[model samples]
Target: MVANPARRAAVTDAALELLGREGARAVTHRAVDAEARVPTGTCANYFRSRSDLLAGIAQRIFVLLAPNPDRLDELAELPVDDAGPAYAGYALERLLAHPNLARALVELRLEAPRSPEVAQPLTEFLRAGFDMDVEFHAARGLPGGREHVLRLHHLVNGIVLDALTIPLAPDIDPVTQAKDTARALGR
Candidate 1:
């Protein structure tokens, strides 16, 4: 079957919505087709199996959440002392902007352990993003090294997960929490 970029994107997006709203159990080819408002079998045409569909949602989440290059360039121009928190704030803002996307990602992460096919691509994509962040931090002479970057990733993951689900400190804004966490870790 000829691949339609728009249709594929729509299918993935619909899958994401399902994953976000109803968890992974609700995401199937037929459900995705209904959610995306596409013809039956359209999701299967784009994603051949359940694993393929889940993996596609994982990819689509990152693509949707990726930082803006122009903004990254702006953050890169900040002083080393200021850059980390600035980037953290920007990243949190982006994640907050798409709560469903973040939730979808959380869903995928949860599913990864049960399915090797899901785990492989998710791990690869996540590691690739982490490596890119480490490279960018090093190349820009940001305040942290690989370990610091790794720490920030762990911290941010917790922060985002908490903010999305049960907030430990609901009164404290997530963005503020992210910036503070980044600043402390950057040192």
Candidate 2:
């Protein structure tokens, strides 16, 4: 059995890489085992079923994609009206830079509705992200409150989705889109 947390993370990382590089169908336990360079049956030992593996992958996605704590702290201390655009544009730029992460997340989200195992992980990820947004806005006494945070969450998801799948016109800038969305949040 896979007893080490590092080994489990490695297996999940391999599964995430497979999901990004191939698709959901390519992330079987044996494939992850081979990709992770662990012993055969290692992934199976760690994850009892396909759904468990998928859930593990979902968890890994958040670990890889979540913002840096330092950056979050800095943003939390800044005036929202003055710093909101900067934060939004920075976030969009980071998202644009990590297309693979976005693809893996989008893939998991697509799979979540049909797979009960993924649903909890996906919901947890969203909740955590939403909570962070709420804290960030509340820390700065920003208006628009929880509803605005939810709207921004949906907007970010849509922008990330477009960044992953749809090719855009040269002039359709993600940074601009983010800034516009932030502005709509009523400062």
Error of 1 at 182 (Å): 1.3
Residues 1-187 of candidate 1: C-alpha lDDT, one tens digit per residue: 5578988988899899888888888998999999999999999888899999898878778888889999998888888888888887887788778887888888899999999888988999999999998998889888668999888888788888998899988999998898888998776
How far residue 144's Cα lies from its native spot in candidate 1, in Å, is 2.3
lDDT of 2: 0.81
Clashing pairs in model 1, backbone N/Cα/C closer than 3 A: none
Give the TM-score (vs. native) of candidate 1: 0.95
Displacement of the residue 185 alpha carbon in candidate 2, Å: 3.8
The total number of steric clashes, by the backbone 3 Å criterion, in model 2 comes to 0
Superposed by TM-score, candidate 1 places the C-alpha of residue 86 at a distance from the truth, in angstroms, of 1.4
lDDT of each: 0.87, 0.81
Kindly list the per-residue Cα lDDT of model 2 for residues 1-187, writing each as its tens digit: 6489988988898888888878898889899999999889999998999999999889888888777878867767766675766576667777777776677788898899999899998899878888987887787777777887777767777787776776465468877887787786664
* Number of the top lDDT candidate: 1
